[model samples]
Target chain A: DQQVKQNSPSLSVQEGRISILNCDYTNSMFDYFLWYKKYPAEGPTFLISISSIKDKNEDGRFTVFLNKSAKHLSLHIVPSQPGDSAVYFCAASDFINTGTASKLTFGTGTRLQVTL
Target chain B: DAGITQSPRHKVTETGTPVTLRCHQTENHRYMYWYRQDPGHGLRLLPYSYGVKDTDKGEVSDGYSVSRSKTEDFLLTLESATSSQTSVYFCAISDDRELLGDEQFFGPGTRLTVL
Candidate 1:
């Protein structure tokens, strides 16, 4: 069963525009959500995250909004740049301890392409 | 990233051969995990380790075995290679601070091809 889902496989947007990527989850037990960006042949890099307690978190040009009732979360990058072109994955975890087998469930990933 | 390293960055092996991938971390974090990435499957966890000699299976652990002899090293072994096992594998490390909500840092990943 896919607990986390990123229905969009790919997205294209022009530079200076806002790029929005969406994710949905089935399990309400997940208290932590994260976004990671990956380039070709490279490991994923942590981008942004939101706790279950909050509805939105922002850092610089990136923002994450979570809606607990909808079981959905989204990442928005304002004034998207070409460097923002990469695959974005949404992950959810249930635990806070590292030694407790806290496994992260990832979405299928959405590839965002930004053109000038 | 988190001083995590995955050795044998690229490999090509034939079916039925035994293969092992190594993940080493200098961060000394308590948690380590192995994941495989595919086209439509995203990243699937194969195994994870909490401490030395303490390990557990993830969502997909079939045809694979893992060992954590020390805090710094985690090894994943494919008992018998198969074409379906050809995918990029990633190792990640994270601390125990759950309340502060730290994120997992990933290694560069190793690409394996089973012919």
Candidate 2:
């Protein structure tokens, strides 16, 4: 079963606009969530993350908001740039429930396209 | 890529043949991982090693085996390859010096095709 789900396959947004990627998880045991951005032919890179205890975390232009009750989290990129266009994968880790704290369950991923 | 290099970036092999992929890291991060990426599936863990001679199975470790004889190298072997095993594989490393050691750096990727 897919514990993490990214329902949207792709998203298109204009430059200087906001791009939001959504992810949902079925397991409430997941306490830490992260977002990774991947380009074609390249491996994914860490973007942002948030703990279940906090509702939001921001780093520069990228922000991650978590809602523990809904089992949902979103990555928001404000004033999206062309460089931001890539496949975004949301990953969750059940640090509190598992010994392998580094183990992560990833969603299918959502491709974000920034238009000129 | 965090000093991680996966050799044999692309390979093609016939079914039932054995194939091995290598992941080498210069950083000596202490934690290594293998994952496969497919069209519908984002990325699934295959096997991982915490240190030399210390390894564990992951989510999708059925047809794969891994060995980490040294701190800098992790090898994944697919004995009797199957067409279903053809996919892009990635190797990641993590430094668990802190409690939140969830950040993992990935290698470029290795594309394998089983004919």
Candidate 3:
């Protein structure tokens, strides 16, 4: 079973517009969520993350909003740029007893294309 | 980005052959992991290591084996190659003090094709 799910396979948006990507989770034990961006033939790079304690977190042009009651989260980018065109993945993880070996469960990923 | 490197960036092998992929890290992080990415499947964890000689299976570990003899190296072996195993594999590492779900730095990934 997929603990995290990104239902949208692809999205297209024009430059200077806001881009929103959504994700859902089924596991309640997950206490932290992360977003990663990937380019073709490259490994996913860390983007932004949010803890369960907070509802929202922002980093520069990227923002992540989480709704615990709904078991959902989203990443928003303002004034999307062509450089933002890539596949985005949402990952979730639960706390570990040792605090060193937390495992991550990832979504199917959403491909975002920014048109000029 | 985390001083991680995956060797044999691209490889094509015939079915039934044994294949091994190597992940090397200079970060000396306590945790290391291997994941496979495929179309529509996202990234699926195959195995992870907490320390040298301490490893565990992830969601998808069938037909695969892993070993960590040193802190800087993690190896994944395919006992017998199958077409179903054709996918891009990634290696990730994070420090011990990092919180759960903290950022995981990944290697460039290795693409493997089994025919």
Which residue window of length 10 is worst by lDDT in model 2 chain A? A93-102
lDDT (10s digit) by residue, model 2, range B53-81: 98888899898999999999999999999
Chain B TM-score (each prediction, in order): 0.95, 0.96, 0.95
Residues B36-76 of candidate 1: C-alpha lDDT, one tens digit per residue: 99999999999888888988878899999999999999999
Error of 1 at B55 (Å): 0.4
- Looking at candidate 1 chain B, the ten consecutive residues that score lowest on lDDT are B94-103
Chain B TM-score of candidate number 2: 0.96
**lDDT values, one for every candidate:** 0.92, 0.91, 0.92
Can you tell me the DockQ of model 3? 0.73
Pairs that collide, model 2: none
Expressed as tens digits, the lDDT of each residue in A42-94 for candidate 1 is: 99999999989999999999999999999999999998999999999999988
Candidate 2: DockQ?
Answer: 0.63
Q: Docking category for candidate 3?
A: medium
Name the weakest run of 10 consecutive residues (lDDT summed) in model 3 chain B: B95-104
lDDT score of residue A107 within candidate 3 = 98
In candidate 2, position A108 carries an lDDT of: 97
